[model samples]
Target: MATDNKTSAILHRDTRFVPKKVVGGKGSYLFLEDGTKFLDSTGGAAVSCLGHGNEQVNQMIKDQMDQVSYCHSAFFGTQVAEDLAQLLVDSTGGKLSKLFVVSSGSEAVEAALKLARQYFLELPTPQSQRTKFIARLPSYHGTTLGALGLGGHVQRREPFEPLLSRNTSHVSPCYAYRGKRDGESDADYVVRLAAELEAEFQRLGPETVCAFVAEPVVGAALGCVPAVPGYFRAMKDVCEKHGALFILDEIMSGMGRCGTLHAWEQEDVIPDIQTIGKGLGGGYAPVSGILIGDSIVQTMDKGTGVFRHGQTYQGHPVSCAAALAVQKTIQEQSLLDNVREMGAYLESQLKQRFENHPHVGDIRGKGLFWGLEFVKDKATKEPFDSEVRLSSLIQGKGLEPEYSVSLYGCSGTVDGIKGDHLVLAPPFVVSKTEIDLLVDTLEKVLKDVFASL
Candidate 1:
């Protein structure tokens, strides 16, 4: 493990902690410069869905490079870009009718927020009064200011809280593990959460609300937490009642990350505005996008006939080609089929290994994305002291030579500063054998970590 690289020139994510140098990567493993092979269980914060150095996606990037690498979206659009948008629309079966491509998950979320605001401005009556947004607490949208404003992740938003949008408010997240009362049934808990959302709308003056944005599955901020059944439908109904848009930020959980093209597919409601990335380009290129519903498309068509948003690198030909090829590869190879099958296997293995473990308080997730929440006192569900930095310690241990594995460790699951959890989201193409190795290595890592603590 490499740390405090005073001699290095690069300013990394954690300046004080320069991680091990990865020389190469393939399928579900990464090769470090020291000749150690690490099982990429979390896919580098769940970004490398297809794993590293996929040849078909790499070839598509090369082919697009030969043609035209970058072109400003203001002047012209490439056929590859057009085709990628069409593919996304088609994949939605016309439920979502248009696309606004961007370079990253944050950009996609920024685009979504802009589109929601503009969509309102373009409506027949032009509801300029609709200026407020409501998102779920403990949810993560992205890191850009606008996206960050919408996110309720306290730790990520702490420094930027002063700059965040006051118009965006947060409601209780549908986190049954923590929110559900001891004797509450799932349905009753959902109803209470829905009522809380409704109350937030009424308090905000329903006419002034623009949208209710949320993640179908909570990602890093809360560890792969999926909403309870019928929870989204209920929340969407409240939005419809208030004449507010129902937006879903699927940037970290979409593009087949949740065993479906869109995470909302599993739920009954399709979002009026959807943001996607991560698996969209499968780490081949930088890409993310906003999918628009017919109502918003019609509004824009009738009003400005244009979306009042533009980015220098939006819809780059090379990026679109890479995303399209990655998507096609997922379809052609039927990787999502493996996702479903191996998801069950991964879930079973995680539960079998962690369910009875003293520190593991909760096991949650859907598809291949799973998280194990650790507790200092299992019966009380008390978190380890944040000072101990349990999650960070677990993550750092994972990178050690003895562990030689990668897992996503996160804290503050209980109020953005109290609980701790770790996630395992392998590539869609991962096999049962790889899943076994990942879980086994993680179990070993946990043993060593807890013993030290």
Candidate 2:
């Protein structure tokens, strides 16, 4: 995978190691400059939903560029952006009235936070005291300061702690693998989590909280863990009781990636603010946004009629157009049904391959988003030493000629420093043969790595 780093001007995530070079991609695979091909199993942090070189998405972007590439959203309105927002609202049956588009998932969270605070301020009674936010620990909202502050991944947030806002606090997430103690039923765990959330609000003075933020299906921080039954409902109940808006960050797990248009659709609760990205634009452009429920949208309409926040690229025409085309493609092609069928097939194949494997701790996810948490001892669920870098090893090996695969890998799944996980979020347009190739390659990769270990 070595390309070159000495002369590079880009400051990549790792300067110590140079990565492979790619010349082009089409469908479910990427072609290296030298023509070495690799299946894109994780889609570069799960962003490329429609897959590489999607003609419809590309055509839409090009057409949008031909029309108007960069119209400052502040002074003008773009029909493409408006149409995108309308599509999103209609997808939710208009339960959510508005969406504020941003350039990335981080920006969406930032906007949601600001809007939530403003929602309280615009209320008739004006609860300006509602300034705090509660998010789950071992969770990731985004990488920007406010989003990072709100995200509870300890190691990622530690270096920037002094610069982050102090108003956001954390509570335990609904990670059944580690969070559920012996003999704790799913119903019991939900109650316990709800109580903990209530306690956090009480300790912080419930009146001071503006929103409760969390992911419906936990991403990297917990390795594709979905909350237990009734979990979201319980958390939302706590938030409602505290007069705090409920916010769901579905950046990595929404937009038909989870076999549904919205991950919250399966949860049976509507979020007051829902942040979506990654799959939103299908890697056609830098994009993300927050869909606001009527409770907050109408409140602002009756009051300021303006959300006191704006980004230079907010509601960028090209990005919105890309997203709209991506969504339309998904709908027109019936990709959600494929996600369900393929998801079940992928799930079955995964369990059949790794369920009995000693090193695979858990296989968790829904639809196309799945993850394998590596453990040293499955019985005790003890994680490998962080120094082993097992997840990255699996990822690196997966990309080698022998395997020819790409996956999203991360460590510190347990307490931000003690666990390892490999994510498998293939493009929504993947086919059965591609799924077979992915699983077969993964099995060989896992077996090969475990042998050396």
Candidate 3:
């Protein structure tokens, strides 16, 4: 069992005071120590797609435990792991090169980085091959050292700047709302962004860059923003021309969150290495992994006959069982269909309620994920003063009385330190009534906070 230390020794992300203790969870709500239930709008950073107390997922875990909780992969293989891998490969149309599992998104990312480097090494381009990683500014991959370096969240990287990788660099994210010129067409804006990526590749010498990493739908960073039309295809073309790998961090945007099994399917491009998590196990277990493209995997299979990387928990039996159940549930129930239907309803509801609101700057998202940008002036799209902590205030307001909402606060949408946004990612199984409640509560909370401002 874990032992409790002194409050100061806890070393929480925020040290001002203690956070509320969660005692239990049930049906899309989290119960706190004092018995207050929060609506769970953010689904714990968009992880709990199945929501709290999903019986099927829980039963799958229990069954796996009853059979065999774990066994070292070095000595033996588990059917659960093999089946899950087969499921994933089948879902991707048998095009995936390999599936490397890990315990978390960060681990998945670390593996991908090492795998990319290894791929180059095996191809004899180990020396002249690209060694640099190019990701967009304001994007986040994960929190570990390698993943952290790949991420561009300034605030998160500030304290760890000295320890981060110098091999990684940032470029502009294809955020049309903020990135588009005053009168630039969407197509022109995509071209401009593509040009920026090309320039970066040229600047770094294309052969020296290992991969171009991006979140197909910018998650956590720019608030579920999908690229403008032709943006991804153009970027993929550029990467192909440069002989660089395209790695996508879909930890928050894939697995039907964007109305497709893989978000890349909607973008008309395929990543050489795709990192997925959160929805993979639907928060039933801690699991994330990399789905490799045919070329990279084939190169390694033929050259080394073994991957040079792995984790202790790689292909964990219990985690794989839970994830397999989650995947099966999504497929058997056709949850992606619901994601599209309910996503349209949620988008329409948000637009109807906030599109013309005085202080609401933007409402954007895909499927069940969404974000609301708060601003002081709608005409100028000037965000609220960060000092006011408008996002926090709205979040606090929503977690009152009977409704509990987790608002994901984001800054730097306007710059690296000035804007604020609230992300809402409810469960995939959410009903119209529940969505209405979320919309109503969010509307009320925003209004109350705006009035206070």
Candidate 4:
């Protein structure tokens, strides 16, 4: 298994990168082939909430493999999937009781989009009345054709514009830091965002709108931006008034990442269809799924008598087992408290390190998921020129000698192309010492980069 170095066949993230092959991981560190250890601060795009190589989760996977490796959802339903669904439903207090299993976050999001479409089809309205979806600019749902269409990330969609569906419409995201007008109060900002959504539905003909898609806490696209108070409540009202379903994509922001089991819980609103991943399986396995409310399930239950769309690996046994164990660990061990505690510590450390730094314009996020927004001018909140690629620069600098932190890079936070942000979503099990060290390492790297500039 070792010798054939015949030009790697896999498509690396960066073609120029001969990335040091990772040999193994333990705790929060990833070990490379050269025996170098790097702290995985971003958890590979925030997926590994439980950190690497947890014995409990590993053991659970082994037990499941020994008992039963795979069970096709079409002809059979495994106890693992059933139990996992039950646990998730109980977590939601039965609000979202039905489940649709998928292997990835993108798949989960695709299911949500289809489910939302189906939800509207089940409505008494005409087929043409339920064909449009509303999403926010600078947002990301997933990468599949359907989910990508639902997303508003300009750069990601630019190449696929001709192929994407034309039924989707865009609205301004609730990004108070960048979208809120000057002199606008929090309430006013929320109202303005809601009005924009309402207007979008109107422009698209409210009757033709199937659902409104959004992230409860904007992840990746806007760098963990949360909405202003009452924002979701207002948006939910608008959707309901228009006879449209509210679909929340919490694939990156939910499942205890935002100090609660669900990000929507903090918004004082619940979606008709919810998409969750990342923290769901804590990266112990490839697990992501849709949580369906009673209304949507009842519609399908009474109309088609079966969910029309499904996957071959839906409710995968091993995936379900790993997820169930991860969920149980999060609950039984009381990890939410750690998320809050460590999150606060991380926030304080970040503020102490970058609050007054000239280029560090914004330090925002909740729980352990945080972001650092770089700027050329802090007063006007002007972003660093896109050519500078501050996020990428910091990422590279972080991995240099004497600094082994891995930072998540993102672009287009401002007006879809100008801003740069580095997101840090460390494992929920991160310690205060680790938080301190991470912040210190980040501050040093920032200083070095700024000084060079």
Candidate 5:
């Protein structure tokens, strides 16, 4: 696969192969170097919310570059950063008091973890023993060491186990499709999950726990699985009971990607600290941020008057300008309204197409973010062996000439090594026609892959 000079030039995610080169992109399609255009159904891991070749965002980057691009956070601050931060804070109705901008989701999460610990330390009654975190199994936060420690994806953390922080522990996620017992009511399931969290806190000596971190809508590791109704509120109650912060990792599910600007908004719960990324900069620039709530901010303000952490490029001017433009465009264009409308259309189309498929065990998600979990037997919900790489096959088939669609596929949805699922997160600008094409292409790809299997 790397026989060609271009393919061998750089080390890709898998050294065994290099993907086709995409020369350009426009709207919802990416043009390969060979002239084939593939529909970007997954938005490149749900990052490109505004789609490609956005003229306004590109112009914004250039304009910012002409003025100032890089400014060290410790030495100076930029208006672009302040404006973006203010907009983010305002969007949350001041519930989130401050924004700590960073380059990626992992960095944002790392900052959040550190901030949580610092918040406890800054309290009038210091919680010096509060050093541990409780995260959900089959969840993904980020790749950085600190963020990875807070995640619960077994396979991902396996290789780095020796190096991971022992301060973190895992709990079962609120995965109704798998976790809920037969004939169990949603309320009962919520109670069960909440009890499990409370048990974990007690087991860890509740006073030693700093936070309970999770993605409101589980991403890559669990394939866009949303919490059961009232699940987050219950989980937050447990956290509050233990005096631990509730941190929501909204990297792949926020910034209007999940109908609402923040995924937690739909859950009747607000996190004390939130990390947002992916769609924040709309793939126009590398940008992510932590939304610090009033309690944390006020504690810092009254205690040290400064956060102990700082990054050299904490708020790169160009990145801030690009994100500002992307966010403003989302608001001025009222893209959330489109997201809701198109999301409903997409959901209905997917159910109509795959609800009865033998291999499709479950179809779940919210807004434009949706996932299809495949299984060997739909009734039994038995997943194909991980060695089969069913999700990867489906993803590869989408990029073929006949299908021409890009899908996000991941393994280990069940227990971090046994389940297969594909995620589809089209851009907010997706039209009904495009949504139909996406579903049709996905259906064809699934059929083709299953036929071969």
Candidate 6:
């Protein structure tokens, strides 16, 4: 067991905190070497949908290792990889017909961007001028340069701004809590957002744009904010009018995180290119991929007949086997049903607890994913000062021995540098008892933190 006093070789996110070493985990709880158990509410940034120490997934990984763990996709494709890809394709009802597997969410977004650009280039008309992409403000795509440029999270991109690409632009996100006007109806708000997108396309010259990228439900950067009704269809219409592909970044909200198997399913509009990760492998392995629509697939088939981008571990046998097992388990256990039922319960409990809290500006989300936004004045929806670090305090207090609950906290929700919010995404296997405990512990943590302030 690693002692707390020992100097760590791994460079953690914050050197000051140096998080506790987790020794083991099962279901919705993680255990420390000292026997302290933490109820995992955020699932390590919403990745472990099936929870920890899943015997079935573990056995599958081991079994795959015994046969063959590593194989080059170019040299040979494993049956597991093909099976997983086919399953993902079928899950989309043939909407997204092809899969380009990768090792992380960033890689998936990178692949999507490259594929979009290549699609335009490969077309018979050859739109060589279409080199620009339009994303949304307060959205997070990933950390890599191309993906980072495609995102509009101001804080995360500030330090690397010089190195980021200039081909991408951003528009206001469909955040009803703030973006919606005082008396505006949902349809009006959507129309306004669509107008902004259309204006952006015109500003950039429609023929020069390759794609419009967005998240079906904004994650950390905006605290689980879902678009208003008809928001997606409106944006898709604008993209269609401008002849640009519509790409949905489901890296954090897809794969049953938001009730449905795909977040876009709830929106009633399909994306031309979709990227999925995090929950794909349920934290059993690092896996992500780009799902290509029929048009893009056909374009590539008729042109170069190959995607230019490739990763060394693009289709590792073990990762694919683990992902296949994870997906199969979700389907076999009918976890989506549980997610919906439990998610409704969780949402009700959260509203009942924080509805009147002075610091809680909003509580919003769908399925098992939820976010609690903090503010100084609920009436004005004024966020707390950045220095207050309210979300971090709540996160730290929740992890203390007294609470022993884990929550995901993020900053810059308001404008990429000022807002604070906490996310709760328990595993699909989470029970009602666990949900109650999670809320109770969080209530105590909130009371304790606020009392000190």
> Best by lDDT, which number?
6
Every candidate's lDDT: 0.90, 0.91, 0.85, 0.86, 0.91, 0.92
List the candidate 4 regions with Cα displacement exceeding 4 Å. Answer: 1-7, 124-127
Q: Which residue pairs come into collision in candidate 1?
A: none
- Over 125-238, each residue of candidate 4 has an lDDT whose tens digit, in order, gives 536568889989989999999889888998899999999999888889887777788899999888888888988888889888888889888888988888888999999999
Residues 142-225, candidate 5, lDDT per residue (tens digit)? 998988888889889999989989999999998889999999999999999888998999898999999999988888998889
Model 2 clash pairs are none
* TM-scores of all predicted structures: 0.98, 0.98, 0.95, 0.97, 0.98, 0.98
In TM-score terms, candidate 5 sits at 0.98
Candidate 3 overall Cα lDDT vs. reference?
Answer: 0.85
Residue 118's lDDT within candidate 1 is 90
Query: Residue 337's C-alpha lDDT in candidate 2?
Result: 93
Go through the candidates in order and give the clash count of each.
Answer: 0, 0, 3, 0, 0, 0
Worst 10 residues of 2 by lDDT: 1-10
Who is ahead in TM-score, 1 or 3? 1
Candidate 1 C-alpha lDDT tens digits along 1-453: 886679678988878778778899999888988899888888887888898889889898999999999989999999999999999999999999988888999999888888888988998889999999999888888899998999888898999898988989999999988899999999999999999998999898999999999999999988999999999999999999988999998888889988998999999799999998988998888899999999999989999988888899988899999999999999899988888899999999999988999999999998989989999999998999889999999999988898888878998898888889998889998988899888888889899999999
**Model 6, 1-453: lDDT tens per residue?**
223434777766765546778899999999986789889999989999999999999999999999999988888988899999999999999999988888899999999999999999899989999999999998899999999999999899999999999999999999999999999999999989999999999999999999999999888888889988899999999999988999999999999999999999999999999999999999999999989999889889999998998999998888888889999999999999999999999999999999999999999999999999999899998988999998888888887888888878999989999999999999999999999999999899989999999
C-alpha lDDT (0 to 100) for residue 31 of candidate 6? 94
lDDT of 3 by residue, 1-453 (tens): 012334446777655645667898887788888778778877888898878888888898999999999888888888989999999988889778578888899999999999888888888445445689999988888899999999888877889999998999999998887899999999999888889999999999988988999998888777888888898888888899988888989999998888898998888788999999999998999999999999887787777767887678889999999999999998888888988998899999999999999888888889988888878888888887778877667766776654467777777667656788878888788788888988898877777777887
Pick the winner on lDDT between candidates 3 and 6.
6
lDDT comparing candidate 5 with the true structure: 0.91
RMSD (CA, angstroms), candidate 2: 1.0
Better of 3 and 6 by TM-score: 6
- Model 6: residues >4 Å from true position, as ranges? 1-6
